[model samples]
Each structure stands twice: as structure tokens, then as C-alpha cells.
Target: MERPQQPIEHWLDLERDQLFLWVPVMLGLGVSAWLWLPDPQAWTSIMLALVAVALLALAADRGGRASRAVAIGCAGVAIGLGLIWAKAERVASPALTKPSAVQFEARVERIEMLAPRGIVRLRLVPIRMIDRPGRRSAAALPAQLRVNLPIADLPMGLSRGAVVQMGARLVPPPPPSVPGAYDFARVAWFDGIGATGRGFGPIELIAPGDASGGELRARLSMHVRAQVAGGPGAIAAALATGDQGAIPLDDAEAMRRAGLSHLLSVSGLHITAVVGIVMLVVLRLLSLSPWLALHWRLPLIAAGAGALAAIGYTILTGAEVPTVRSCVAALMVLLAVALGRAAMTLRLVATGAIIVLLCWPEALAGPSFQLSFAAVTAIIALHESPRVKAWFAARDEGWMPWLARQLASLLLTGIVVEAALSPIALYHFHKAGLYGSLANIVAIPLTTFLVMPAEALALLFDLVGLGTPFWWVVEQALRLVLAIAHAIAAAPGAVTALPAMPQGSFALIVLGGLWIALWRSAARLIGVVPLAIGAFWAVSTPPPDLLVTADGRHLALRTIDGEIALLRDRAGDYTRMMLAENGGFDGEPGLLSEHRFARCSRDLCIADRVIAGRQWRIVATRSAYLLPATDLIAACRGADIVVSERRLPLRCQPRWLRLDRPMLAQTGGVAITLATRQVVTVRQPDDRHPWRVPARAAQGSDNLCCSMQGLAKQRQL
Candidate 1:
């Protein structure tokens, strides 16, 4: 007889058993997404193996331990093999040292319907290095090619297997230089993109962008465009088909203000809508059949509807990374319910995350991926918490309870998400949305129900000749919504003050919070600790005074005696914290807008005069900094350097014989740069020193961090 299993062993066994074939398959797909890296062969090989492991696990469900173990082993080996293959392929590809711009015959692989920037992805036909190209090499396969369109023509749609070619400037991918941010090249590579260019150049229609079965999707897009009309037409197009090319920026903001911006993409809502429609159709058809109708067949219909909905949505959305991730998550929900297990939102989210990260490793770094998933995860987690549920549960039956629940959930979600992502958002956009929640409350819903769905309806009218009426109605409604969003966004206190959070601190917050919230057991428990630490850091840490950004990207620091001084070439007068954040940086938690930057710069000029009159000075700009100097003809001198964005200003200036960049940077970091040849130490113990940037910048260093543009240059200032 088999020995009795110990309690611990039983628990372990149960947990291990959760590792089904699909888990590995999903894992592999996620791993495959890393194809965005310079490793397609690896991802492809891994993808194949992951699929194999899934098959093995499923096949061994009724088998003994040995069989399951074997399956797991094979799967693991395949994943490893795939990774190795990717590495080899990367080494095999020639270093893109030669800058060759040419008109080549190529295949259009994919099209990204990004708003404002429509990118057409292409795969270059592999060519041999020799005269008579022998066997085609994977190295020559296009890993990067994109066509940046004006969203208008891009939303027209393309299918899988379309042929196209164009001109572009060939260059190496920008080297990784920023910490805790997404990679740009990998995004291109994953889509088989070799280069990005403007204009169609020429279009010889080899095939319809939609393939054999995508005709219906094409029809839907055309129909919706006709129904919505102008801006709303574009909005509905985005909703119906994941194509938002025509929607004006103002309209998009209105929907955002309505707190319903999520509806624009082909996410849960679109899937749900499609599933509902499909299920209704299928169930009614079954009802007419009479036989299947009596057997509680709705579940089967629901499943079928969900599957169909997923496929339809995928095609409509052009199957971008985010949309694909959402589709996979939705499938998990449907699958869990169908399998008789309670569909846990968090588990679905985790599963989806695993799928996304593994399949497209680059997405792990993208802000859209992070923010969308964050908001979703927070909402679901809050909804599922026993305490929160109970709190809402105890309420009496009335509108007050409903309203209270909505407000509470919103507040919790806003605080948690903003708290979680504020650092990263600032690090990337250089602006945080301080009053985003207030704007979202009024915006998200209005966009969701009023704008999105109504716009989607207009598409149907477009199918027929009479599309004007529906289109007109949507435009009128959209204008009102747009007006409201702008009015509210412009309202006083809609945004608040925030500047760039330090890079190191920002990274810690995102990594720590994500870990705590996602991981289970002891790991998950420790996650909240980071969040607490981050909150304290935020509230107590005062704003920087001497801030500098060069190459118009990287920003660097200084904090002053209760007032902030900014040094940037961007906008200023809009520097009110509220304007930057509420403008979309989540109410401007960190970093101000160019408009604000401009305003502040003007004021600084005045402040510099007052400061100079008192014999107090600070280095404020790359234009040799603000110093009091009287050479009697040759040199200008003041007491000392006040603030310095120039890493070493005086040395380059020949005025001061000896120069210490660190002394100035530290002093400037604290907005105390007031002396030259005088090395002043910053007293803040937590301040990290020398703050080296990744890519070199010849334009001078920024306070917060250097931008990719800043570093991609050949020279450093």
C-alpha cells in the first residue's frame, strides 16, 4: 500500500497540481512575448515548447506521477532550449553597423492603430549577404520596420499576410539608458518591424489587410465610422474595432474626464458587449431548436459566445499587445466559470500578467501595460477584499449606499493606483495627474456609456447609405462632452502641484508595491511595507529648488528655502502643479508641463535679479549660470556658483581655473549652489551622489534623470 501522505505533503501536492498544462503554455506565450527582444528564434522555439508542455500536462491528467513529471521535464527543457536558441540567433544576426536605406520588397506583418501615430509593422524578406542569395537566414528576417501614419489612413485596417515596402532611415536601436522603464527597440522587434517611416510612399495592393475570415471585421469598422461621424466616428471606431484614428484629442480627453477612457479600447467592456450579443443570438437559436434549450444550455452558449467574442475583438483591435493581454484575461474568466471554479479576478489578473510578460517581455516595461493592469488589479482586489466587501455589505438599501460604495471604491482605487504608479508616471511623462480622480469621476462614465456605446451604434448606420443622421447626433453629443471635460479640467484645484520624484525612489516604489500586491504568502504580506515607506517619503520630502533639463528631456535637481526654482527650456507659466497633473499626469504629482515651465522660467529671471542684488547667487541655466562677476572687461564674478545644470560650468567657462562638478551638483540638488572652487557637501544622508546617467548627453545633465534622447547623442556636456 502507498504510504500515507503527510499534511504538509498533501498541501504541497495540491499546490503543485495547480500547475496544469495551460499554466506552462501561458507561461511560454508570455516568454514568447520576449520576441520583442533581439531574440525571435528563442521566443518562437520557447513558444512551441510551451505549447508542447501544455499538451503533455493535459494528456497526463489521468496518468500517474511519473508521467506528469516527464511532461513537466520536457516542458522545462523545451523552454530552456528555446531561450538558448534565442541567444544563438541574437549572436548570429550581423551588427546593424551599416546604415542602408533602400526600397525592398517586404511583407506587412502587422499594423498598430495607435492614436496620433499609426504604425505599420513589416517583415523584410530574408536576403543572403552573398551575390546569389542562397538559403535565407533568420538573421536577415525583418525584426524592425514600422510606418508612422497620421492615424487617418492607418485605421483603414490591414490583415495578416499583406505585402508592402517603403523607405526609412536605418539605424541601431537606442541603447538602454533609463532605469525601470520600457525598451523601445524590443517593441519594434517583437512586431517583426525593421524600420519606421512616414507616408505610404507607394501602395500596390497585394492583398487585403484582412485575411480570409476578417471580412466581417472590416465591415464593422466601416459601418461604425459611418454611424459616429467625425470625432465621435473615430471614438466609436476605436471602441468597435480598436481603431481610434479619427477621434480628436479634445474628444478623447472628454471621455477621460467622464472616467470612461477604458471603454475606447477593445477590452473587457467590448468583449462583454460582444459576448452578450452573441449569447443572446445563440441561445435564442437554441430555444427555437427545443432539444438543447431545455438542458440548461446557456452556459455552453455563454462559453461559445465568449470564445467568438474574443476572436472578433482580436481582429477588430488589430491585436495589439494590450488588447491581446485583455483577451487572454477574459478567456481565463470564462474558462474558470465554465470549469465550475469560482472565477477569481485576482487569479485571472495574475494569469493574464504571466501570459503578457512571458509572451512579450518588453511590455513589462511599457507604461500603458503597467497602468491599465494596475487600475484593473486595484479595482478587482479592492472589490474582493473581505473587509471592503463587508463594509459595503452592511449598508442599507438606498441610493446612498450605492453612491457611497462607488465613491469609496473610486477613492481607494485612485489612492492605491496613483500611489503605486505616481513615481513611474513622473519618471516617464514628467507629469503626474494630481486631480485625475476628480476629473475621471466626471469623465470615465460619460465617455463609457454616453460616448463609446452611442458611437458604436453609429457604425451600423454607416453600413447603409444614411449615415449622416447618426453621425451628426454623435458629433453634437461629443462636443458637449468635450466642453465638459475641458471645463472641469480647467476648473480651479482640478490639478495640484508635483515635480519629478527621484529615480531611485520611484523604482523602489513600483517594484516593491507590485511585488506585495501580486505575490502570495509571506512575499505578498511584505509588499505593503514598501508602499508605506513610499508614502512617507512622498509627504515629507520637500520639492527641489534648482532643477535643470537639457536636450529637453532629462531633468536634474535642487531644493531651496521653501521655494522651488526650475531650469528648463520647455513651457513654464502653466507650472501650476494643478495644470500638469490634471492635464493628464494624474494631476501633476511630479514634473510640470512645458507651459508651466515657461511661466516659472520668466519668474526665475526676475527672482535672479532680486537674488543678485543681495549678493546671493545660484547657477540656474546652461547659459553660464547666474553668478555676480565684474572682470572690469574680461571675467564676470560673484560670491560663488548658485546652481548648476551644467555638470561642470566654470571649467568650460575658463573664468574659474579649478572646477568641481560634484560640489555644484550637490549644492544644486538642494538648491544651495552658491560658491565656485568651494566644495559644498549636501547634508541629506539619503541623497545618492554623482548620479551617473546611462546614455551620454552633450547638452548638459538634467536633475531628475537623463532622457533617452539626451543620451543617444555622441557627446556629453
Candidate 2:
């Protein structure tokens, strides 16, 4: 006589152990809330009140089971918010404002050699910075500076902790190039890099510090490059030292396009390989002694050895966030083995993510954190599927069948991971690698089994001058990896570019994916609803119809042909590239001056286009010279929008919007959509944060005629 399980009880039983998997998701939501809030302080009281409610719910003994789960989720979110706020406050430092030529004495903290650029980048902490020519009081220096110098100009004795004096021109970390675009300034702020500069005059080494691990890493990179040469060498050096700066831009681009860029970063795959190798070698050595194997815990000893190796390698390779995360995951695996527990599970991934989020909440805003976690989570979910488990457990009749099964599993994993990460790629990079999964099927195995091991062996042999043989193997393996990358990247339909989507859509997609991955039973399939809706929303959102650069020197407008046309054909490469990416256009931008619908002149330009069933007229200034007062007024009077780098005369006003110098200075850059009459600025009016510089006071407007008269009087004086 056995009791039958109720339907609800069975469902609950299925998900009982899976509940913890949602903790990281809750924490990430909180982090996202903090980051996305325009004014964190304004929402502070509300968030804390919610936390209080959650706590009371938890403390109460008479509530529904659902209430307890909700309480746990709220607590996780509150902790995440508190963590990020504390980290931001703790790392707060002065940031440089404006540009200036400065001379300073500083201690070098780190160095990166950019071989293709022929420059050396140094992270420095300044002792004192005096303005150039000694004509003004010393300017307030940032907590840290990143400066680039010509390779030839680098002092021979320069090394980490070395004190040096140099003259350089520095500028504050730049803001976003467009509204809702990537914010490098915020990234720099979190990293404690307040400014960036280029060396000008001579750099004199005042004190050469003692030998350090950073010096060792640099020497190793140089030695590897010298031994291997070219792009392959750069990749090998990156594998060895985690210094990816030396990789040629072309090679890096190819790798990114081919979806093998993860190989360049030391993460789970690399760490797992390193740990497995160390454990196997150590275990084999211990087993060689029969008495020791019988008397001692050889597995435990090997696990300890592997843990040490993982930590040592993590530190040696600069300890990037992904690498550190992998190291933690690997250590946890080793700990599980030592304790005789099952290792790989959703819990392990969730635990690692929670630990990382706790320590570096700022990492939540970065692609590395999102992409890595998404990939891992997807892979784990795929393998843990009941159907997949059953298939894997089925008897293998022969070696060929087993091999086929393995290949199929790898392909399936790759596809799942690519699917999980595509939304993120589109949101951050505005593009997704369509062929990444296919490329990774070959690339991951090749990199994990052959390339990394060969590189490690080559490095070991280099110590005694016997590394040439292994180095050849390393070079050939890396060459094959590059060949795969370039071939895949050159293929048609290798990438899919999408218009940037709103944060809400992206969040919905992520939540849907998490729901599917973190749960079991029939309800998990319900996630498809939100997932499909989010995908549709992201794809259907229209791009901005107008974009203006921060300096107001470049403008792009959507034409009747649906092509993005730039005002200047000679715009800088970076700006042009970003605009194209944002617009989801692959071709070079056609010049608006050359477009059929626009009329251009020496001092002014006028363009007209129909958007959302309405014709909009746009006017822009082309020259610094003041236009005729009547001409300026006439051009703007009927226009829907006016864009000018110079402040317009009081008589010149647009019906809808006017973007002039003062406004551009405050907003940073702007993107507008004609259909909804919506406007977005790189720096929103309420984006007063720790790193943002305050906008200057505006000057009073004057009529063109009055300005001309004043200019004439000054000339007469």
C-alpha cells in the first residue's frame, strides 16, 4: 500500500532543489536596477522599504509558502543593491576635466605593449602634476592615469613600481558616443582610471624598482613573440600571459567575427584544462608509489595540487574577471572531489556567479560577466536535460557511435550557448556571430586539447633552451586556429547586425531564458512566451532617424532611400564605424551633401525627408562664419529642427528642436527619432553621477546683426 503523489506536490518536488538557482538571477536584477535607474537616490527609499517588507515576511511564521520564496528573492536583491552602492562609494576618486598638457612624476603600476600600434601603455599613479609651461597653478590630478608612449620612447629601465617623470597631454575619460551607447567613462571610473593621455616629451626613469611578476610577464611576452613571430606569436603570448593588447587588429577582428574570441580570454575552458592536466600528472606521480597510494589519500593530494596550480596560473595571467571566476569554479570542483561529492551542477554555476557578483557587482554591467555566465548556464541546462541524459546513457555499440555521440553533444551545446548569448551580443555589440557555434565546434577542441597544452609545454622548455620543438607545435596549432577564424569570418552570412534594443526588451529575454534554464517540469516550457515576445520587440524597434556627435562636428540623418547619410564624408573612422554599427548598416555612409534630397552651400545645408507619414525639414550650419541675419532666420523659421555647432542668433528658432553648442556641451551627444518625436542624449539631464563633469553656464544669445557690429568695433579698436 503506497500513497499516490499529488500533482502539485510532484511539481513542487521537481523544483524544490532548483530554487537556489534563481538567487543569482535575483541578485543580477537588483544590480541592473541600480545601473538602469536615472536617479538611484530617488528610488533609494522605495527599495529599502521593499527590503523591510521582505524581511518582515521572512520573520513571520504565518504566511503562505509563496511569501517565503518572495522574501528570499527580495533579500537577494537588497543585498545586491547594497553591494554595488558600497563598491561605488568605496572606489570614488577625482576625475580629470578638460584637456591639458601636464608634467608629472609617477609610479608605473602596469604596462601593455601594443605591437601593431607601436606603443606601450602604462598605468600610472601620479605624485604631482603641474600644468604645462609652468604658467598656471598645478591642476588636480586623478587617482590613476593610463598613458600611451611610442615604443621607441619608452625608457629601457621602465618597469612596474618604477618612479618616472614625463610630460604628457591628458584628457578625461570620454563619455558615450551616442545616447544609450557603451559608456567607457563609467568603466574607467570603476577601474579607477580617471584619465587617458599620450606622452609628449622625454620620459626619464628616476628609480627602477626591484624585479616583479609584472616585469616577468612582460619579458615572457616579448620572449614568446621573439620566438614565434607574427600574429600566431601574439595569440600564444596572450594564452601565456593574458596580455591581448599585442594581437593585431585584423586578427582580433577575424577572431571576433568567427566567434572564437573567447579562446583569447582565459576562462572556464582554459582553467578546466589546466586543472585536469595538473591533477592527472600529480595523481600519476603519486600512484607510482604503491605504498603511498595505499596509505595516503592520493586523490585528495592531487586535488590540492590542482587547486594550487589553478590559483597560481590565475595570478600569473593578470587575474581578469572571467579568469578569476573560472578559477573559483575550478577550485570548487576540486573541493567537491576532495570531499567526495558530485561536482558539476547548476548549483556550482549559481554559487560561482553569486560569489563573483558579491565581490565585483560592477561586473554585472559588463559583457564578460553576462556572456560567460549565459554560456555556462545554457551548456549546463542542455546537458542536464532528461532527454539528453537518456541519450547519453544509452549503450554505445562501437567506437564510431561513441565518437558521433560526442560530436553531436558538442554541436548541440554550442548551438544552445550561441542562442543564449545572441541577445546579449546584439544588445551590447549590435551584432551577433551567426557562425560562432559552427566555428567553436572545431575551435574549442583544438584550443583545449592541442594549442594550450603545446603552448604550456613550449613555455616550460623555453627555460632550458629546449623549447624549439614544442614551439613549432604551438605555432602550427595557433596557425590552424587563425586559419579557421579567417575562413569562417570571410564566409557570407557569418554575422547578423541588429538595431539596438531597449533595456526592457533585453531584460525580458534574459528572464525568459533563465526561467527555462533554472526550472524543470512542464512549466519550464512556458518561458517561450516571454522569449518570443522579447525577440519580436527587439527586432521590430526602429533605429534613430538622426544622430549627432558630441562635438557637433558630425551629423547623420536617415534619407528617403532608408540609407544613413553623413554630413561630412571625412568624419573620423571611429565615429563613422560606431554610427554604422548602431544603424545596422554595413556599407560606407553616403555623404548627405551628395544626396539628391539635400541642398548644400558654403555656410548652410537643408535636408527634407518623410518619416512616419510626415515630412520633416532639417537645417544645419556648415561654417563658423556668421550667415546673413535674414538668411539664418529664414532657414530656421519653418524647419522642424536646427543643428549648429555655434550658438544660433536669437532670431533663429526651430519649431520643434534646436541643438546648438551649449546644449551639445551639456548633452554630450544626441539621437532622435522623427516618428515619435523622441530625443535621447549621451548624458541625460539627470545623469549627475560621481564621474560626470558639471556643465558650464550658458552664454546669452545675440542677433547675428548685433554680433557682426560688435566684431567690427573690436577690429576698429
Candidate 3:
């Protein structure tokens, strides 16, 4: 008999970490060289040195298993580093980009409509630069543009696979990030784009465009949507199709509030759901066939079909990064089963992860990639337990087996997935959904049964004369589904914005999740680490310095001499998320109230107006003060210090009001221009309201000064 194998371990088992160390370090070093090295010689030297060290380490570790480990790490690191270096160098090639416009021709690869901003991905067309008179010879630039098309009046005919041409400005995507900053432009580049543009380009229609990927894929996608049109259906379509575009923000909010957003997004839950669905259906169908039941291949066919169907569904739904990563992982597990090989467990995960990284290394930077992979790894180990699997599979009189699985799996799997992912979510999104489980329960069935199917059918029917009933029914169902989602979302306590959790919490959660996934164990107590840390972090986060309302009203506290100046009735989504994370009151609020600027409230800092003197100047205070102003002809002038507090009834020609830095810049004047143009020789030394007095200069100049000061105070708050 063969020697007993080590039971399959979790992906995060301690040994896996040892494996991970080499890859990340190697890749990180290569990335470092590419990012930090100034010259080609430095790049070559660093890479070679790192390679030599890694090789030496591998050679030293050569002693059966230990040697294998070293070699694997070294090889993995080498590959990752090599890839990063290639991409960096390709982008850096001096001849690759033209600084001046040259006439070119390229194909339109994609069309992304983000309401106000539409992203049209195109292969390069030639660019031509217009030489300016009296200008010296300069670098020639490419004549391409990533069109920033404003579609207040959106055009209808734009479709996938359509080619067109136009004139625009073009620039390369930005470089990789510095140690601790975002480089979004560089990200866009890796997504296979060069230039963006706006409005319609001069077009010559190449051909009538059909839905993406031909009939079966498109039809299935359409069917999935049609089936899930209403109730849970809309959610199903979202998860199944990556078509969250049609989901109303409010409905989405409700799902989020209820903590069921993942159910509607085809996450690990969806992948696992499909896998179970395929496994059960395949086994049952085979059992029914007298001849097929006798053959082991019957179940195998079922498994294959089910897996294919799930993958098909994923493809129909646009196969977003999370879904794609999940698919890769699922496939890895399935392949092992089909080959009748002992499950590789963490090693399998490592293999799958390496495959994905090699294909899209840039995905490492995305939250979906992190969360999806992490969640899958956790659930894989959880499901591997005989006890856990038996419990889920055993008879339950409460509901249908499938339905029960749906519910249990949603909860159990969600718990596992969320445990590992909560930290990242909290750190990045800055809040945890308290009711996500409940949300998923309501959403799962709706998506699987109604929305995904309806949408799929509707799209199919659209192409054929026989699809009317399906289309109509799907549309009705979609309306109903969306309505319910909206209703649930609007309920009280539906969504509560929390403060930002720490990055440390998220990192720890990943670490703990990894641990739980890697080690084979009967009890799953260790899985609670992520949940515990996330909760503690969420609850303890501090209040915000500024809040911006959706309507553009901004609420923030500004400090002058440790006193807070409150800009009331203006708080927005961005500000709310920011405040909860940074959690500090830079200035002491004199007053706080609901919906107004008054002193002393329960919020982090009050939104009360304050005007206090600082060390450098007599900073005056004014709120809702009325002043006079005069207007002159074009040549005629105005006041030196013009302070427009709220608004003056009389137009001031030279309303020189001294404005404070409470309304303009969010930071102080430390970084403003030193050019001083306007000053007032005040006639009244002790006017109760010096701010009310209109001096003889321009209001615009005072506004600039006030903006600078306001900016300073704003950062503190």
C-alpha cells in the first residue's frame, strides 16, 4: 500500500507562508528595481544579485523536502520578478511612444459607459502633431486620446466591436505606485488601454454589432437575466452578469445595508453555489439512469456539465476579476478530482494563485482579487471537512436540500469568506455591514431563481420573434425585484456609515484567514480572528473633520487658534467616510446641533461658526453679516478688502472686505503664492463688525485670501 498522505491542509497553513515568503520578496525586489533604479545598469545588477542569492539559498536548502521548498520559492520569485521587469521595460522603451501626434489607425476594442464618463478602449490609431510657430523642436507626442465623452444626452448607436476614429490628446498611463500612494493612471494602462476620448469621433461603421461572444454565451446571459428579473432575480442578474449598472443606487444601498451585496455579485458564494449545484445534479441525474447509474462516467459527465454551466454563467456575466479568480480556483480543485489525484489543498491553491498572477499580475492590487481569492481559500478548507460537509449534506426536514444548502452555504460560506475579507473591506470601505447575512438570505434565491434567468431569456427573446412572452415576463419580474430591493434598502437602519478601520486590522485578518485555511483541523475556532479584529477596529474609529452632502453643501470644522469654524448643512459621502477613519477634532467646536451650526452636540466635532485671532494677524469673525458694495465701469476699480459673507443686497463696486481663510482652502497658507496685491487702510479701528466694512479693493482678491485660510482650517478639521 502507498504511504499515507498528509491530510489536505488549508491554504494558509504555516508551511504555505514559508512558500509565500519567497515569491512576494522576489517579486517585491524586482518591482523595487524597476521602480527605484534610475539606470539600466543598476537594474541588471540588482536583478542578477537577487537571482544569485535566491539560487544560493535553493542550493543550500537541497535536502529532500527542504530542498524542494527552496527551489520552488526561488523559481516562483524569479518568474514574478521577470514578468514585472518585462512590463516595466516595455513601457519605458523610448521609441515605443511618440511625443508628437502622428496619423495612425487602430481598432476599437471596448466601450464602457460610466454615465457622465464613457471609456472607449481602442488600439492605437496614428497621431499627427501641429507644429506651433516660434516654438523649438520638441518631443513628438502620439495623436490619440482616451476620450472623456460627456453624455448628458447619451447617444444610442455605440456598441461593442465598433471601430471609429477621432482627434485628441494622448498620454501614457502613469507609472507603478510609490511606497504608499495610488497610481490610478498606471492601473488603467495595465487594463489594456492607451488613450481615452470624449464625444463622438468621425465614424465609419465596420459592421452591425451583435452581443459579445456570439450566441450561446450571450443567450445564456440573457436567459439568466430574464429568469431573475424581479424580486431576487435582479440580484441574481447582478451576480451572474456583472451587470450592476442597471441596479439603482438605492436598491444597492439596501442590499449593502442588509449585508447581502455579495450574494448579488457572484462572489465565492456564487461559485460554491454553482459547484454544489453541478455536483448534486450530476450525481442525481446519473442515479436516475439505469444504464448511466451503472457507469461511473455518468456522474463525471454531470460534474463536467455542471462545472461548465457555472463557468458559462460566469462568462455570461462578464467574468469580472473576482469571478475569474474564483473560477481559476474552482477549476484547480475540479481538475484534481477528475484526475483522481490526492487533493493538493494549499499547494493547489498556490498553483491556482500562481496561474492567475502570471496571467494578470496587476490584479494583485485589486480588492476583488484579494477578497475573492482569500474567501475561496477559506471556504475550500471549510468544505473539505467531513463533518462540515456531512452536516450540510445530511437530511434536514426544514427546507429543500438545495434550498437549505443555499441558505446554510450562504451563511457558512459568507462567514468564512467575510472573516478573512472583513479587515480589507473595513480598511478600504471604512465600514462593516452589520446585517449582511440577512441581506444575502433574501437575495440568494431571488438571484438564482428569478433575475439571472429572466435577464437571460429577455436578451435571447430580443433576437427572435418567439421571445415576446419571455421578454415581457422577464421585464415585469425585474421591475418587481428591483422594487423589493429598493423597499428593503429604504427601511430604517438600512445603511449606517461607520468609521474607517485600520489597514493593520485588514492585514491581520488576511494572516489569520490564511492560517485557518492552511492547517487541517476539525474545529474552526481560529477563523474568528478576522471578525474580532474588524469589529474592534470598526467600533473605535474616530469622527470626521469634514462632511460633504450629496448636493454640494460641505460641512467641516475649521480651527483658528484652536477654535472651530463650522461650515454647516453640507456633508457628503466622501467626507463622511474620511472623518470616520482619521478620527480627530483639530479644532474645538464652540457649538453643535442637528442640521445647523450651534454649539455642543454628540458628534465628533460641532459645526459652529468661530472667528478667533491668531498669532500673525487679527483674524476677525463674521457670519450672515450684510455689507454694501459699489460697481464701476471696466476701467473703474473697487475696494481693497471685500468680504462676501452670505451675500450683499447692494452690489459693491469696490467692496474691500477682509475675508478669513475659513471658506476657501482646506489647508493653511503655508503652500500658497506669496504674491500680495491688496491691503486696506481701515478707517474704523474698533468697529464692532470690521468684517462688515467694505474697503476699496476687489472682492475676488479677498475671496482668494479667504479661500487659502479656509483651506488651511479645513484640513485640520
TM-score for all models, in order of appearance: 0.60, 0.92, 0.60
- Ranked by lDDT from best down, the candidates are 2, 1, 3
lDDT, candidate 1, at 536: 63
lDDT of 2 at 652: 79
Can you give the lDDT of residue 693 in candidate 1?
Answer: 20
- Winner on lDDT between 1 and 3 is 1
Which residue ranges in model 3 land beyond 4 Å of their true spot? 1-82, 90-106, 113-157, 166-183, 195-197, 200-241, 263-296, 306-316, 319-321, 341-347, 384-412, 449-505, 521-717
Task: Select the stronger candidate by TM-score from 2 and 3.
Answer: 2
Predicted candidate 1 versus true structure: per-residue lDDT over 1-717, tens digit per residue: 654434434443554533442343333334334432233454556568666776877685653454455566556545544543454345332223323444444555544444443444343442222222453322242444454544444423356566554444454333221221223444444344443445444444444554654455556666766655566667666767776655666666655544445556677656656655556556677678667767775777767786777877786677777777777777787788788887766667767766665565545556667776777766676666676787767555788879988788767666765655556555554445555665556545555555554554555555666656656766776566566566766666543334444444554566566556543334356766776676567545444333322121223332222233234444443343322331222332232222222223421321232232343333233343444333211221332223333343332232221122443322221212222211222222222211112111222444323322222121122
**Of 1 and 2, which scores higher on TM-score?**
2
lDDT winner between candidates 1 and 2: 2
The superposed Cα distance between candidate 3 and the true structure at residue 132, in angstroms, equals: 12
Candidate 3, residues 1-717, lDDT tens digits: the string is: 632222323322434444553454344334433443444565567667756766776676524344455555555555665676566445432222322332233334444433212333334333334344676644543332444444433235545444444434443442211111233344544544444333344443434445466344434445655644443444444555555544545566656655556655776556656676667756886788687776567656765876786688677666767788777777766777788765446567667666766676656656666766666566677787677888777574666767767678778876765556655555545445544545545556665565445544555566765666665665665465555556656666544444334445554455455655655543345756774685566566443332222111223333333233334334444343333333233212332233344333222222223232211111111333322222211111222222222322333222222233323211111111012221211111222111111111223345545554543343333
* Predicted structure 3, TM vs. truth: 0.60
Off by over 4 Å in 2: 1-13, 131-134, 559-563, 600-605, 622-631, 693-717
Error of 3 at 716 (Å): 16
Which candidate wins on TM-score? 2
Across 1-717, the per-residue lDDT of candidate 2 in tens digits comes to 533434545565678899899898888887877777756674486578768979787886243455577788888887787778778879988787677778899999888888778889999999986555638865678889999999999998788889999988888888777775678888898899978989965889999977488878888888998889899999988888888888998899899988899899888888898888889888998999999999999999999999999999899898877799889989998988888888888998899899999999999999999998899889888889999998777684899999898889888888999999899999988888989999999988888888778877878888899989888988898899999999998899898876667888998899899999999888998899899889999998888899887777778887777678888757776788788777766556788899878998867789988888998898988777888889889988989888898888877777777777756766667788889877766765454455663222122223323433432342233
Candidate 1 global TM-score: 0.60
